[model samples]
Target: MQLDRIDYALLDALRKNARLPNKTLAEKVGVAPSTALERVRRLRESGMIQGYHAEIDPQALGIGLQAMISVRLERHARTDVAAFDTYLKTLPEVLSFWHVAGGNDFLVHVAVRDSQRLRDFALDAFTTRKEVAHIETNLIFSFQRNARLPAPPRD
Candidate 1:
């Protein structure tokens, strides 16, 4: 869908707080509640609004540390590569994983209670796999999210 100013306004409002009711959203975007609801529906149907989720405090949930594991696998075959990707998803500590072109084949974001668990994950989960050639784990001191894009300059 081609987004007009109103669509951008609605998206910005939703990004700020997805829990906002249609009534409040409409008020913020200067539209009727029904219109806001329809627009939201259309946005979802068009795949512009992927999904809504709450931002939780991992620390409060007993997760004290975050780490990124850069994994380089020896596997060159497609089947083996796919199997590794699927296996990564089953690991509880894995928050996200990316397949990228670099010295590392995969970059994995993980969260654990402490450094010991991180070490355990690297040794037990990754090193045990014969296909995994090299693994580097880095402790994350700070993490930030760019939740929304800045609006285009006014014409």
Candidate 2:
């Protein structure tokens, strides 16, 4: 869908606070409340806006440790990759996973309660996978930008 300045303004307002009332959004974007509501609906329908979620502090939630794991698979065959991807989805501690272009086949974001739990995850879970050949783990010290919207693509 082609987005004009109004649509971009609407998106920016929603990104700041998804729970903002339609009236407030309209005021911020200088549009009618109904227009703001309809624009949001269209954005959602077009898959531009995926979903809204409440951000929670992991430390407060008892998940104090975060790690970025680079996983190298023994074999990069299609079936093997699919099986590994499916297996990753089954692990709750595996918060997010990405398929990358370089040496590592997958990059995974994992969070756990503490250091011990993190170690257990690496040894007991990650290492034991049949298709996993090598793994490198990095402990996250502090996050600079935790979450931010992706910038619109360049023309």
Candidate 3:
């Protein structure tokens, strides 16, 4: 579905705050509340708008450190990759992971209590896994997110 200027405006407003009231959203997007509601519904149906979520502080949840680990797999077979992916998902420390095309098969982001826990997690999680050929971990001192997405491509 083609998105017009109004759609783009609505998307921008929603990205900054998904909890915005329908009336507030409509006002920001310069449309009637009913129109804004319908447009948002259409966006969801088209899969343009995914699910909304809250951004919680990891520190508050006892996460004192975060790390990004690069993993090289021993085997690149579909079964081996799938199994490792499944195991990663089961780990509560795992925030997210990317299966990428590069020197590493996967880049995993994890949150832990401290450096000790981070080391233990790496040894227990990746080092012990036979599928993992090699692994490297880097401490994350800070992180940031850009709320607004770039403008969509023109037809």
Candidate 4:
């Protein structure tokens, strides 16, 4: 959907903090509470706002280590890829996974309790899979997320 200045302003305010009260949000975007409510509803219905999420610290959940595992598959058939994707979804350690181009077919992000768990996770998750041709694991020291997205160019 084409977004006007009000839409962009509402998105910017929400992106920074989704918990902002409706009154505060309306104030920030220079709109009346009811208009802000209706506009946000429209945005959601249009799928502009997919969902809101809370950022949680991995360490707080007893996750001491996190790593990205690059996986190269031996086969590129649809069935093989789909099966692998389904398998990744079942893994509790997997934070997220991306199917992408390049040398690797997939990038799997995971979190575990310690280095041993990380090693075990890699071996069990990737090395055992027959379709997996190669796997590379990289430790993540720190992570950060951008507060807001760049504004989309106006038509």
> Which candidate gets the maximum TM-score versus the true structure?
3
User: Against the hidden reference, what TM-scores do the models get?
Assistant: 0.90, 0.92, 0.96, 0.95
Instruction: Give the range where candidate 4 is weakest over 10 consecutive residues by summed lDDT.
Output: 146-155
Q: Write model 1 residue lDDT over 56-123, tens digit each, in one string.
A: 77899999999999999897678767978999999988899998888988999999999998898789
Candidate order by TM-score, decreasing, is 3, 4, 2, 1
- In model 3, what are the clashing residue pairs, if there are any? none
- Give candidates' CA RMSD values in order: 2.1, 1.7, 1.0, 1.1
lDDT-superior candidate, 1 or 4:
4
Instruction: Report, for every candidate in turn, its global Cα lDDT versus the true structure.
Output: 0.90, 0.89, 0.95, 0.93
The CA-based lDDT of model 1 is what? 0.90
TM-score of 3: 0.96
Q: What TM-score number comes out for model 4?
A: 0.95
Model 4, residue 130: C-alpha shift (Å): 1.7
Return the top candidate by lDDT.
Answer: 3
- Those runs of model 2 whose alpha carbons end farther than 4 Å from true positions after fitting are 146-155
Worst 10 residues of 2 by lDDT: 145-154
Give per-residue CA lDDT, model 4, range 1-155, as digits (tens): 77888999999999999999999999999999999999999999999999999888889999989999999999999888999999999999999999999999999999999999998888988899988999999999998888887967967
